[model samples]
Target: MTQAAIPPFHLAFPVHSFAAAREFYGDLLGCPEGRSSADWVDFNFYGHQIVAHLSPDEAGHRATSAVDGDAVPVRHFGVVLSVPQWEALADKLKQADTKFIIEPHIRFKGEVGEQATMFFLDRSGNAVEIKAFANMDSLFAK
Candidate 1:
């Protein structure tokens, strides 16, 4: 399937503070702002609607699962870009001195699902994973 054929999805996640959410989602991630209120803010996250709802008690990732030798955060969200775009974003993140939960690297090398992936957290402690495959068709290969 083509990227354009994938419909945009909506997500509503917790954030500890609106200010932190704004800087992380709006400024750092470069997502454009949408409708918002004092309790929540919406961002165009890579073409999808992701709202950051202020809820201090529910803002952090607390679970993990093993994946390719990494203790991958069980709760995370991100978009899949083309390899070049992913690499560019990785570079930008590195230049900003972003602390990665799992530094960017290719997983499943030489396997059906080989892909470049990385993990990091937003200021609110929400884990986010960004990835890209050498061949998009391999995204769901088994």
Candidate 2:
């Protein structure tokens, strides 16, 4: 059987406030904003659609999991970038004085499928991870 290629996806989630999300995702994360209305907003997050729907009650949920000795968010979203692009983003984050939950660093160093990864939180407290693989194909390698 032929394996189906993985393509980019669209994601939509609830947000407490659009104003806060706009400033955090658009201004801080540098994601370009697209079509929007009073009820929702769209962000071009690394070529994916991330729609923030207005829902104040759903704002405070937080989920976690243990990873690399840290409490990583289980309910989170992020993008996989090319190595150079990932480095560039790390530099930009450093320049912006962003606080990282997991600072950018190499993981599983010298091992098969080693990668560079980092995690940080958005204004609404949503955790986001940005990672790069030495060999892109290793992304799904065991």
RMSD of each: 1.1, 2.6
**48-109 per-residue lDDT for model 1 (tens digits):** 99999989999989999999899999999999989999999999899989999999999999
Clashing pairs in 1: none
Best by lDDT: 1
At residue 136, candidate 2 shows an lDDT of 81
Error of 2 at 70 (Å): 2.6
Q: What residue runs in model 2 are displaced by over 4 Å at the alpha carbon?
A: 1-6
Tell me the whole-model lDDT of each prediction, alpha carbons only: 0.93, 0.84
TM-score of 2: 0.87
Q: Candidate 1: lDDT over CA atoms? A: 0.93
